[model samples]
Target: MMKKFGFTLAEVLITLGIVGVIAAMTIPTFVTNSQNKANAAKLASTISNIENAFGIMMVQEGANTLDETEFYQYLTNKDLEKAESTFGEYLKLQGNGTVTNFYGEDKPFKYIGYSAVPENITLSESIDVYQTKNGALLMFADGFNEITEDVAKKYGISVTKQYFLLRIDVNGKENPNIIGRDVFVFALCEDGALYPFGGKTSSVIQTGNPTSRHYKNSSGSYACIDGKFSAGCTARLIENNFVVDY
Candidate 1:
């Protein structure tokens, strides 16, 4: 027989063990990467759908200032009426005025398809259409109306207050400047100016919390919109198709 180039049993076992160890370490990483990529694709697709609907609505209505309800209504009423669409089917607005689909649940307009699910999204809360005293809208969670009196007192704002231009910054903390008040509004001006209305500025604004900003402070990472922290800003903007100037 040709001098066997193949390794002996012991040597082969050792090599196999090493290969197994490497594979064990890399498989989870690969899976995680794959999941992230899939989620990204889904998000992009959803955003495109939403933007397309918005574009249609704008063309028909001759305006770009539609509320969350109006946007959904446009999709379900007009877009779906004309074209059989996936997003319209996925977003089954309920009789109680809530919307549901593959995503968990949403409180109207605060967040639409913003949560992270393997295949769907959940709405974070309802949108606050009011403005704050400082001219910034109280942009945060949608369940603001459900906050307890003590919690409201702690934040120095009421549950009925609304915020505009909400930003869960890189630190994952809600900007204190936008907390509390009614009628929050952040206008993305034609000149590319971001203006916040309502709420007062405090000298010591807390920053960095995963709940609000969705990033660990020690990591020095920035807040990600829609629970995706690793993607670029342009990708996010393009996906959402909404102006997130924060």
Candidate 2:
């Protein structure tokens, strides 16, 4: 014989089994890492698109002052429905594109997606808008209806006011359905900055006060309170500073 260069059948089987075990252990880890990377990329891309839209609106308006209504109308007129759809598709979330009393929808005025909903929470709108000193529109929201101390502990970050920003203009000289009283919608946040759950709240309509906005539950209480609604409510800017092309 040729000195038995290869192992016996039993030996080969043992070797193959070891390889399979190793593969099973590492494959899931690799898959999970890949998923996280993809999600992060999608988030960054969505943010960039929104920023670009705002920039365009600002240039058209000739100034960087806008209200929530102006922003919504501008988006609708421009037919930027892709922004919301892209987000939902990438996140594997189902949303309606119509304005409704609930939070998550696929409406042209609502950016709906899944977030960390708390226990015993009802559906509600949690939108906020702000105007920056540098002519930028800042919007923010809480991904969850309420960030309880226990939940905050689980995330390893203190439950703060989560939010996002959309810098645009609303002078109305550029488009119709634009131009409105500049409103600064503020929310009560004792924790920290508002968390913007990507473009999930982009298509939502502006409920509550346009000046000082607060999320309310089905019972008409602040949606940020624990035990009021589910924990997965996402905070976002339904509409921000944006000018329309009149």
Candidate 3:
């Protein structure tokens, strides 16, 4: 008789209801956390791929030093056609998919927000943009500074020395495309390989130059905070191997 003792039907139902409530409260948080982790991994993989490719090409060309313009001559063109030829034809990649020298699409990219867009221009509208199969975005203009050649001349800089910007939309045009959260700026120096905008954060890159200036802004919060943009976190996350710490 004692062994038959158990909770009544009403008590069991109450217990189940409490369990459901707890799940409802926690599931969304868990889902978000999981997605963030996966996105972080994607960011790491994507940037690493680009960096490695650049290194291999440089070594093959036997180049010890290359300015931005020379790098493009060694790598891509105005339309990055050579990039497609090597990375696509030979490497069997989607050629990282070519993009035009135009801004947003006749179909705008679904996720148009930029967490850390530069102080210089419009996020999606001002730059020529391209998207890759891995969900990363390549944004560059004809010259530097602005999307026109005049700007480069005004700055006395060529397109090669000015460098290009990368916005990695972890989900690729998906919703909640907040910059820094879903996107980060991976800036490639005109003369150096790709590194997060705030390059000093990378131990490997900043190794001997403790006093060297990599990024002017030093905000390192994972999410764009205090009105700070996502670009600030690029070097931070890159140095951390693309694992964003909350």
The lDDT leader among the candidates is: 3
In order, candidate lDDTs are: 0.31, 0.32, 0.51
Give RMSD to native, each candidate: 14.1, 15.9, 7.8
**Candidate 3 ranges beyond 4 A from true positions:** 1-4, 62-77, 80-83, 86-92, 95-121, 124-135, 141-162, 199-226
Q: Please identify which of the two predictions, 1 or 3, would achieve the higher TM-score against the true structure.
A: 3
lDDT per residue for candidate 3 within 1-246, as digits (tens), equals 367778999999999999999999999998877877787887777666766666665566665533423446634354455545544421224333323233223332322243333445444343444455665565543333222445344434333233455556666666555555566665454444554654542212222222233433444322323445445556666667667663
What's model 1's lDDT at 175?
A: 22
- In angstroms, the error of model 1 at 9 is 1.6
Measured by TM-score, the strongest candidate is: 3
Work out the TM-score per prediction.
0.37, 0.38, 0.63
**lDDT tens digits, residues 1-246, model 2?**
566587889999999999999999999977755543443343344444444554454455453332222443433343334433432222222222221222132121211122333333322233232322232233333332334455445445443332232312221112111111121123212222222321222112122121122233334322323332211122323323121110
Please report, as a residue range, the 10-residue window in candidate 1 with the lowest summed lDDT: 197-206
Clashing pairs in 3: 68-160, 69-160, 115-179, 115-230, 116-230
RMSD in angstroms between candidate 2 and the native structure over all alpha carbons: 15.9
TM-score of 1: 0.37
lDDT of 3 at 16: 100
